[model samples]
Target: MPPRRCTASAAAGQTGSDSDLDEFIMRCLSCEEQYDMDDAGTCRECYQEANEAEEELRLEIDDLKSKVSFLTLSSPTLNPSTADIVLVPVDDSDAAPIPAHKHVLSCRSPVFNAMLENDMEERRSGTIKISDVSHDTLCAFVNYLYTAEASLDNQMACNLLVLGEKYQVKHLKTYCEKYLIAKMNWNKAIANYAFAYQYNCKQLRSASLAVILDKMDLFTQNEYYAELVDTNPRLVVEIYETYIGKQLNTAGTL
Candidate 1:
């Protein structure tokens, strides 16, 4: 908000003595209250403008939310009679197949588009086998494809992000990335950094790196960091390289 207070000292330069009583007071442009200009936050115009913009944004958000609800596909039912294809979790033989429409999958992911359109084994057999994911995670992933919504948590966010990365679902990947970034702390930063780097989640990687750098000592003591060093020494080295660079810049500033 613009400061509510302004002084007539501004007018003194135009025509009055410096010590003049009339020159010492001025009315605020916004509240019309007279105050000294030297004090901080002496006006309220910026606050009013910000409030108006916020209200406009809220109205737009309501419209967008309604459109989303209208466009979202209905949640999958227990019956798969109408479904065109089934997704099988290869790791779980006893797992029930997740029924879905080929068209919806194709529209959502280019990878799925290629698989469904071409003479792939999945197209021939009508069974799309997914690997390294649990039945529950697969169901949640399919649901998000149909309706851009998911009940996310730390593990779920990480699981879905991997699937999203594999399928090249940019929106889902970004969604998961944001969730992970929001949940990240020093304790999880190293693992998140490795995961983000592996998946090419640039924004999440940056956030994780920032957290890790802030607590480098704690990162070195973390068991996950030790495991990461054993499994991917190069990524661990990259962290130190970045940290050293940041240190050098700080020293230069000093």
Candidate 2:
């Protein structure tokens, strides 16, 4: 919730006598009703400017997305003759290596650049092995490397997020974070918070914490709550401590 703010009209009369404050009737831009000046969320000007700024930001994002789309290259795998290396996902059963260009992979991920540019086995054998990820996930990752696009589900998003973090692909990690944040809710709050914290996703962690604070009474009812407590009691303690601290802050404010 936003803090109460007075309109410019209220401040205009502040230079005069204190009694002039009451003469300025508070008007809500949205509801158009008389509200106490001390009980307003925003003035009309601030609200309108915020809306305009949001729209401008949205347009800029769209423009950047368009430029990314324009710059997206056709996968070199489509022309295997042009591909210089293959990616092997060791987690899958006899998974086929996915073809990719070494330069593309190197450009997209610093980890890949280090592996391929140095005198590593991957540089010699022309095959890069990725572990702890299934072939499908690896395929999705490679496709995104080439296309700057991915069709994400919860599982895919989680998998990609891990790979993104490991490989230092900040863009892909942010993309996964946005998906996970959008899908987040009370039922998934605790697990999401734990995952976000582990992955150092500040935005997702804050969003999940907000949800948890809203439904603290229902926290224990979630099945994941017990699992989290059993697996990482420290994290559970941290959450409780955070909640208690916020409660203390609220008490102080009141």
Q: Best candidate, lDDT-wise? A: 2
lDDT tens readout by residue for model 2, 115-202: 9989999999999888899988998999999997899999899999999999999999999999999999898899998998898889
RMSD of each: 4.3, 7.6
Global lDDT of each candidate: 0.87, 0.88
lDDT against true structure, model 1? 0.87
- RMSD, model 1, all Cα superposed? 4.3
Candidate 2 residue-wise lDDT at 93:
62
The model with the greatest TM-score is 1
In terms of lDDT, the poorest run of 10 residues in model 2 is 1-10
Candidate 2, residue 37: lDDT: 52
Candidate 2 residue-wise lDDT at 25: 57
